[model samples]
Structures are given as C-alpha cells and as structure tokens.
Target: MLQDVKSYLGRCFAIKDLGDAAYIFGIKIYRDRSRWLIGLCQSVYNEKILKRYHMENFKRGSIPMQDKLRLSKSQSASTPDELKRMQNVPYASAVGSIMYVVRCTRPDVALAQNITSQFQHNLGDIKRELRVSCYSNAGYLTDADDLKSQTGYVFVLNGGAVDRKSDKKSIFATSSAEAEYIVAFDASNEAV
Candidate 1:
C-alpha cells in the first residue's frame, strides 16, 4: 500500500515523521489536489534562530537593520587566532541562519553573510572613524558604529552602485552635492 511505500522511503532518506508535511529543506509546504506551489521563506528559520540564540523575545523587527541601530568598536572582542576557534564564536547563530537558506537556492544573501563571517572576531577593530573625506570618497560615509547588523544589502544595476554598502558610511553629509560628488568619484575609480 502507499503507506508502506512512504514509510520505506522516509526511512531510507532519514526523514522525521511530522504526520503532515508542514515544511521541508527550509521550504514551507502546502498542498492542494488541483494546485501546487512551494516557497522558501525566512519565517520558520527566523523563529528557530531567534529561539536558539535567545533572541526569541526580541520585538520582531520590521526591517533587518533599524535606523537607530549602532554597534561600536569600543567593546573589545575576543579574536581567536586559530581557525578552529573562529568556528566557535558564541554567536555563530548568524552564520547558521545563512546556511540553511543558502543551500535552498536563496542567493540574495550570499555576499552579505560571507562578508559577515569573515569578520567574525575583532569586529570592533575593523571600524573606521568619522568626519573623514576619505570615507566619502570610498562611498562609505555614515556612522561606522551603527553598521554592525549581521546582514548586508546592495542595490546596484548594470554594474553601478545605485545603493551599495558592506557597512554604514562613517559620516553624515552636510549637503547633497558634496555627497553625490564623492559617490561619483568613487564609482568612476571603481569602474576603472
């Protein structure tokens, strides 16, 4: 019967019996006899990560990075020199979230998470100071302290920075023209 076949296959593949298929491989499963669809979303994974990392009680953020969020380098971080130690950061929670979704073909966050993991330790030391014209020239001129969220966002098109950032810029601009001038120069140099 179909039940026997399902059991055999499930055992062969090492699947847990959830009774009803609610999810699989990070995808939320829904079925209809006449219609079919499968979607990969962050909902369940988000909750799992929150709970595992003890952030489950945090007010669910509407945006990934808050406008007022800030992380400064003043706090001394424990930078492990060994690669093995790097894997054991108390906060590997950020990396775990990326892996589950990445293998499922969600490519949007690939660059962001990769960059985050690289700076796993000594994240504080990497911060740059404010009010420097050089930062503006390089297209990073916001408060560096506020840019420490575990995600990255880039909005570019045709190989240009429509909006791109690894972290926040280090300084606020006094005027639009000054900001644009700096951005233009940076992009031109990058293209070359």
Candidate 2:
C-alpha cells in the first residue's frame, strides 16, 4: 500500500518509513498483532499538563469536576486585578491540554472537558474502561444560564471507551423526555 501510494503521488510528499509510530503528538500508540488490537495512551502528555498546572502532586479526585460546580460567562474577569490574575492562570492552555486527552484516550472525562472548554476564554481551573456498548444520557435544562438541556454519550469497545461526547442541546428542550429523545438521536447519529 505504501509503495502504491508512493508511485501515485510521485516524490513531493517525502514520505519516510518511521517503523510503526511509537507516539504521535503526545499519544502513545501500541499494537498487539497476536490479539489484533491497537491502543493509545497519553500518560506522558497528562503528566506534562499536571506539571504545567502545578497539579502533579495534588490529590486525586473521584470526579473530574466536583458535583454542583457551575461555571458561567458571569465568571468573566471583572476588576483589573481579577483580569490580571486570570491572564496568569493559563486557563485556556489547561483546557486545551485536557482537550487533547479527551480527543485521544479519555472519554470518561468528556463532560468535564466540555464544560471546562466553555469557560476557557474567561478563566477557570480544571479515563477509561474498554467496552463495546454505548450509554446515553441527558439532563433537562441543565445549563443554569441558558435553560438548554445537555446530552452525554459514550461508546465503549473492548472494555474501554473509544468515542464519547457531551454537549448542550442546540435547542431548548421543554421536558426531560424530549431532552432524552434528543440525546438518543444524537447517540444514534454518532453510531451511524
């Protein structure tokens, strides 16, 4: 396949044989031909993020975002000192680091990452099992400020989550059932 592609594309691409990438960007790639499996991890990337944010030695938490912690645009910097402190907080960078993990190996933290991302412009502070089935869920009017519902879904394969998403519904849901229906639709869309 490589030779055919090389022949078709001529020599402009400058493709080199890297011998089965050990890491791409920050993700560690693993392959087990015996089991017909491939795996990706971001432990090194995670460590860098923790160290960057000075959380390397911090205690672990059961939940990525503590329950009932609501972040809103209202949290945007108000006073001059607050703005200065926010500038030094590296909130966007931290969210971006977590986002890379979310895009790579940790779907369990999708909700937390999504929420953190919403607050990235302002400021704010900030897993996996293998399974094949997906679980879908929704919360009605969960966004305290917007009255929009939220949807969360995870697709697990081989005892680990391979795909996941958590986002606010584009439209407001009048009832919990409608919110659930919207989430189910979103999940099915992802499955397809």
On residues 59-103, what C-alpha lDDT tens digit does candidate 2 reach at each position?
443333444666777767777887787788877788888887887
Cα RMSD (angstroms) for every candidate in the order listed: 15.6, 15.7
**Local accuracy of candidate 1 as per-residue lDDT tens digits, 23-55:** 666677665656675555657776887787788
Which regions in candidate 2 have their CA more than 4 angstroms from the true location? 1-21, 31-38, 61-69, 75-77, 124-192
Q: In lDDT terms, how accurate is model 1?
A: 0.52
Error of 2 at 26 (Å): 3.2
The TM-score values for the models, in the order shown, are 0.37, 0.46
Q: In angstroms, what RMSD does candidate 1 have relative to the true structure? A: 15.6
Query: Which of the numbered candidates is closest to the native, going by highest lDDT?
Result: 2
Highest-scoring model, TM-score: 2
Candidate 2 residue-pair clash tally? 10
